[model samples]
Target chain A: MSVRKTAFLALFTTFSLAVFAIEHAIPPLVPIPGIKLGLANVVTLILLRHFRARDAIFVLISRILLSSFLFGQALSLLYSLAGGLLSLCVMAAVMGLLQKKALFLTGAMGGLTHNLGQLAMALAITRTIGVLAYLPFLILSGILTGLFTGLCAGFAGKVLAPFLSDIS
Target chain B: MKKNTAWRKPAVIITAFLLLLSTASLLCLLARREKSDYAAEIFQDGVLIKSVYLNDISQTGTFIIQGENGCVNEIEIRPGSIAIISADCPDKLCVRQGFISDSKLPITCLPNRLVIRLRPVSDSSETTAVPDAVTY
Candidate 1:
């Protein structure tokens, strides 16, 4: 890979790690177990749009792995991996179909699928189906947070469009 | 730009639909209530370790369950609710979940491999309700 591309990936990875750390430091807005702003996702959405899916996935995996190592427990790593991969797949597919115009939609889809993926992991690890009860509440939170991050991503994409084109 | 606008219309419609569906589901979930006569079953590593009937309990009681790898959890049982008051797990998600009175969800400590679930006490007429069937 080119030095410039490598540098870009490193920079993006750092940005995402910072966002993840900051979000983690803040007390949860609601007492709900898996609810969060998912602010780092804005970076993921941006990377997915501005660069190739391969690059976006790399940044995502690196961010999750690094963040878990720094500020999370072993159990959290499992949940993050499941949620992160599911959301990434959903957002990429949605963006691929709808293009950049539907960035917010992609975000929302990612949010919902991310929660579902976590819940599935929770159910499996806990060995009880009762955890499914959190589905509705999780979905609602996912939609709201997803929409917020998606819009942020859309705005960021628009503002960075000219500069990003130069790098590519 | 023109193509973007066309996609935006469908996107908006889809978002609105999801919002409505989730809202309706949320309301339904909130409104659904579990029967008061039920039993709380505690499980460790997918094995049934203990069962307590909430209706028969009159006083609060607490017990500790130690799992593999030295993981410990303090489970509290009350008249009509059950919860994990404290745990040695790193996340303490089960403790934060607080008390649960219904069968809707269980308190789980993933690191400890501990699960506390409520199962409705079946009467003779309600025998048709499969105990193992996962509803919702």
Candidate 2:
């Protein structure tokens, strides 16, 4: 089981990294910064449901670090790390409360907090309240994108759950 | 899935409420009519590097912002507008943002932590008259 877990975690990390790189390669849908579907978050949602919290965090941190090194600048690393960790914490807490039933709810809340964390980081870095202007848009986009990722993860989890258990 | 319906009711309501609230605010922000006369302030690394009054510019030229991190963003400053004409950042989204002449939107270079906003020129000098004192 331990060996199998390692393999699964490795595969998840690889997939998340590939997704992150692919997201970067694709042109941003909105010309505005900080707007995206965050497709790799589906992997995080899947890990949260199927694996332990630590495994999810492991995949998240690895994806952020490697993606930043491969395709991002130094400052973006801080931004992504802040957003990723905060979103994961929110997802984990919501999962605990709801017993992991409403995956979309957890994802939505996670998406909101993710933008919030990055917003806070941006505020701290800029030391200006001007950036607060982005709040409403961020919240709106976060929920919609999060809901999308959450639903995808839920469907994927349902389809893959049997296969995972059987193979392991 | 037996009791799933119970919690999902409130969850859906909450999601809907939040979505509505954010959308309302976003629309309001967009619909705002702003004054064209303001200072185009450029800040890099959160420090004020340049502030040009859009309404009262004696010179129209471009300047290159060479950030400490070696990011170069060339800003094109015209009389009534300003824009990031080019940038060395990977995304170049700032350049794509085009020119902005009002306070409604700002041209932001995310990688370099650069922000260019059209804010009301500092209202400090009551004696210098309101509109035409700051232009060089």
Q: Across residues B7-124, which tens digit of lDDT does each residue of candidate 2 receive? A: 6665666577667767787787777545436788888888998887788876778988888789988998988889999999999999998987765567899988999988866443
Task: Give the TM-score of each candidate.
Answer: 0.66, 0.67
| DockQ for candidate 2 | 0.13
Which ten-residue region of model 2 chain B has the weakest summed lDDT?
Answer: B127-136
**lDDT values of the candidates?**
0.83, 0.80
CAPRI verdict on model 2? incorrect
Interface RMSD for candidates 1 onward, in order: 7.0, 9.5
Per-residue accuracy of model 2 over A21-84 as CA lDDT, tens digit each: 7877777665446878888999999898887788899989988888878887658888998899
Cα displacement (Å) at residue B121, model 1: 9.3
Tens digits of lDDT, candidate 1, B29-125: 7686545487888999999999999989999999999999899999889998999999987888999999998765688899998988888786423
The candidate that wins on TM-score is: 2
